[model samples]
Target: MIGVYISILILLAIIVYLYFTKRLSYLLKSKRKLLFKSLNKVEKWFLAGSLIATFTFSTLTNLVSSVIYELVSPNSNKEFLKIDEKQDTSIELISESNEKLDKLLKDASIDPRDIEQYLKNLPLKDGKEETNARIDEWYQARKISLEIKELLLVVTKVIFEQNEDLTNTITFLKSTGKTDFAGVLENIQKYFQEGDAEKIKQEYFSRKEKVEKENILILKQSIKSTEALFAFQQTVDLYKELILVEPTAENYFQTAYFLHKLKYFDEAANLYQKTLKIYRDLAQENPRAYLPNVAETLNNLADLHSDKNEFPQAQEKYEEALKIRRDLAEENPIAYLPDVATTLNNLAYLQNVKNEFSQAQEKCEEALEIRKKLAKENPKTYQSDVAMTLNNLAILHSEKNEFPQAQEKYEEALKIYRNLVQENPRTFLPDLAMTLSNLAILQNAKNEFPQAQEKYEEALKIYRNLAQENPRTYQPDVAMTLNNLAVLHWSKNEFPQAQEKYEEALKIQRDLAQENSRAYEIDYARMLIMGVKLFKKDKSNLKIAKGILERYQEVYSAQELLKLIRKLE
Candidate 1:
């Protein structure tokens, strides 16, 4: 009844507005003005009273309707504003988390006082028991919550060495779905004081203004007791920072070398390039002493750039490096053959990327021929290098979309890697898993979905097992496989399941990307863009998709595919 009344009042109000605007009033006046013009004063007065009463009634009804509107739908704009505010808050939280992670990495040696302080400031639950109970409930409600939280908790506990109940914690986690907790253990081993002592001693000895022999001897004694890898990493990082201030060719080379080991590609590339420049200047002044280092540095820089997909830049650097190596090999035929072969392989890789399959094939064959000769004469000594070269050839074949050749090469490589991994499960399983995953990628590309899934699952099992043993190294890999599986599902039009897996992958990437250098940022951004596109298909999310696409290009450009993307309607 109230709604009907309000609707009628609103309609009448609209009519009144039209009349006042002269729309309705003009129509009525045109037809009725002459009829009213001859009216007597008393009659006109009566007519004016009726008109006034009707106007008063309509005005009162409009006022009542507005009051009802306010009561029923009060402050809708404020409610919408609140929702927008929360979304902004979430974005802010994500940004803050990233910053915190960077700070943690930068001040790795600073004893995490800030993280501790933040934890203390965070509102505590009633008690640890109560919190545990709630967590258990969440675990029951969402199986993943318990697994993820426990993995994080255990990893943190191991890193901090805070709790004595680590055995129980590990046991509990081990009982859960095949989650990788090994990363925590590895971090523990890396950070434990005694484990790092040797590294510290070595760094101490390597100081340019060398420590006194007596000091070195004392440091060697101290090394027997120090175990923390994190401390060594901190020391190494400090040394790197100091080296940057007055970077010599040697210092730059050392920094680049270590950064490469740490997989910090951008930093490593910059350092390597700087080292190359310095060495080149030195070589121009005195070619004999610095040429070898200059050539090696160029090659290293080329390799780094190649890995980062700066193929054109990489090709130029590789050619320069190859010229140096080839010139040196001509002079020192016996000693430089291996280096020449390595350069050939590197060149072949670039050629493969450029789709010059025949040229790449010739280069690989040349490298393999040299390696085979070396291996035949000294099988035990050159076995591993020979195996690796074969693997490289296989990869080149894969690049050319020649599955049979690639598969054959992989099989050959697998035979070697399998044996090696079997002899050392802890060291080799991860590599085996990686190989399996690469093979899986090939399978997926061929639309052999079931086979690809099998390979991925197998790789996942290995990675998960390794992650269980050492998560820092392997959990992210498992997450990647999970994502791959999800993509497969998505390709099959299994949207809901794909979404679930994507969310899972996102959770893992969120954590891992925090620790990774900018080299991995593109991968993270791609995943984000892919997720947004998938979600937006049934909705309109042009803005979010565009933002992700923009970020992806920021980290990576020069790909031709981006032009096609721009052409998208």
Candidate 2:
């Protein structure tokens, strides 16, 4: 019985220690609460009752011990317990010091008096040194933050002022159609004049991507406005700056497009080749994602080659694009078949240029068949394509001297255009005019002079109206019609009328050549040659024609001009 009592006492002592330290409760709380809640109501009640009994027993034991101690020592002169003065004071000091240190760490704005007292009372050398080092670090951090704030304010002010000036300048430019770039030019020049050239270049280059994006937006706006050519050139300049920053494929391609439009064919082709190489590498990595872009670039490159008269290169590029389009069409016919048809048409045009008539006809036929099916499904959308293909076929027939077949196709195309114009005259009038011109040429070839003249007059009227509205794009068309008229009169031996028409055509061609000599110079030289032929009978007229030809010595072959001069002498 005594042993059992001692075991119970030991267990009670362990329970008391665990309860005071919270270890037993902490272990229960750390487990999932759901496990305790899973007990039945009776089991929960039993556990509560047992905990209450244990607490009562512990309290009774503590009270009994105190009572016994009071009775047993009531008469003793000394007290049962005495506090240790030094050790108790030491513990109190440690507790106070810990509270003060915690407060200081938690509150950065503690009273200075309290902080001084606390630091002075710090008992260890290492603690004092550590606190001092932390304070120094805090001071340095604050100093750096203040300096950064000041620098930011200065930079913000400078940027705001520059932005305000730039905004006002841009508003002025827009209001004035940007015809005078003097103010903007001055603003750009000011940067160079005020700063080191290398520094200014670096600054411009650092923001070059942003500058390129903004310039591209401006270029789009300029294209819609009357100052498109000037804006295009400015955009090209921006692209050059972007290249200086980073010669990216997209930047090169953008520059190439503008260069092509500006008639800088060689430069445009070089850039396009660079873009093509980059796209090719990218396509090799992810063909499905990038092959369409490759095909588009190839198409543009082919057109560029065609414009430059690099026929073989153009043919090769067009064929490559066609093969890609064919593959894409096979994968998703509904979405990509139109691209296939378009590529076929472009290839056909190229073949026609190369005088590969049989191949050209086959490609044209295939394209027409696709377009016809597409038109049958959605006439409103694809009818124009069908008519365009018909016109192309008619031209091919005419080139082959199959007059009846050419006339049939021309009439078919004309009917389509006429119907289309009835629905939207502004859009389709140009097509009607083009078909009329073709018909007039066909009539002239067949010696139907009166009908040819009537058709030519009608086409000229349309071209004149179009040129009056947008002279930059359509003025050359007017010159072309005038040249055709001159040829018609020349064929009939109406030298005086032919000479007048040729002179008018030459004047327009001269003006066009002033803007793009490579595009218009050959036409100007041809007009001079026609003038020479028309005025051969009159010595004074012959001398005038010879002088005009000599003036374009670079455009015309010297040998050919000399032969003409010898004939005239």
Candidate 3:
């Protein structure tokens, strides 16, 4: 088809050249002249020969020029840089690469930090002498990296140690495998006392600099089989080569997964797109194996979009993935049904965001039904998923004013979450707290004030504990719960309790807003307004609220400030 188009284009070009160069006008000297028929045989033969010669010569010249230019062009090399899904690689080669990768990764972590800290602490700037502070940084980084690498390597070995129960996914997920390499850090610290810092830096930090250089090739666009796949730069280097050499979907998919986890969203999206394209092209020939991959990639990309608040793109990709999963699940329910439920739950939330309440309810209910069956079969695997779906369902029921239905779902979801938290608090505590908070909201709406207060206190306790450990992540949750409890108390005319809760919540909000006004200022403002309304007659609180409003007047507007102050009056 391309050849045919090129042939037609060349033919048009020749005619245009002849017309524009006046060669055609030479044949049509006068309107009345029948030039070809009126011409003598010799003249006619000469015209035909000239036309044939010109056409042949022009075609050959253009073809030769195109060949030469393409051979010399820089863009000819660009194709090699991209992962071409249709490249004709030998099946044997692909299989060999797969086997090699499988052997390497089957029992391996692929990234044991692998001198990552060493690489990071190595002096990137090399103008002046390395300061003692710089040396100290490198020493500390090495000490930390080495210990982490040792600990993770031990864990990985235990987890994937060719056990008889390797297929027991639950055991792996819930593995409380403890490392025996505990006192190694203490020993290192004891030997490398504060006075021996110079010697430690000389022996450890400087020596590892040479060793860590091998990882830099990920940037150099070279492939090495031994490189770690966790650090951003190193993984990019290794995977880019894998994509170029074998062009497998796994290569792109794994890289994208890591990048997404590391918050490299843009590059992760690009790799996911490439992975999806490859899976799609491969699926045209082998749908059974690659279609699942296509759906998975779509789901991941949709998640990335949702995280970035690109909701339209997220919804579109999720629906595409959902359709694919639903079709696959009809044929192989056990294999693909979970994916169907997962996508349904994802889309349900998106629908709720778009205010498509009916569709959201439908999706959530469908997901809940699917997950319930799956959880019955494999409680350890699918129970959390069931709980998640139920939580969403309860919210949908609440949206439609089905209080009893919403209450029932929320209770069931909280029961599952609380059980899961008992088994693995590190994993499911937050889930429990979140459901408790939602249930409390519903209770408050139903005016079950005492029940609401109980649930709020429970959630607030969890949030306070969590905030003590990770204030940056859980402080906002703490403040929000406090505000809820305060309002509950305020509505009951419990002024002392309300004042205490409101003061605590507002202080947290103020601290958080100081660090990130864009995220927390509105919450601070809302709490302030609540406080002012609750204590309208309290001269001290009103004065303080007015002062805060005046301080933040520029953040909103002077008119907005005056109106806020008017509410206090």
Candidate achieving the largest TM-score: 3
| Tens-digit per-residue lDDT, 96-192, candidate 2 | 3434433322223222223323323222223334544544454466632322222223322332333344355456545545533324333443442
Local distance difference test, per candidate?
A: 0.60, 0.65, 0.65
Which whole-number lDDT from 0 to 100 does residue 484 have in model 2?
Answer: 93
Q: Any residue pairs clashing in model 3, and if so which?
A: 218-237
lDDT (tens digit, per residue) of candidate 3 on 495-533: 899889988988899999898876676567666666667
In candidate 1, what are the lDDT values of residues 451-521, reduced to their tens digit?
88888888888877766644655667878988897887787788897788788877787677677634344
User: Sorted by TM-score, highest first, which candidate order results?
Assistant: 3, 2, 1
Off by over 4 Å in 3: 1-230, 241-246, 537-569
lDDT of 3: 0.65
Indicate whether candidate 1 or candidate 3 has the larger TM-score.
Answer: 3
Q: What shift in Å separates residue 196 of candidate 2 from its native position after superposition?
A: 21
Ranking by lDDT: 3, 2, 1
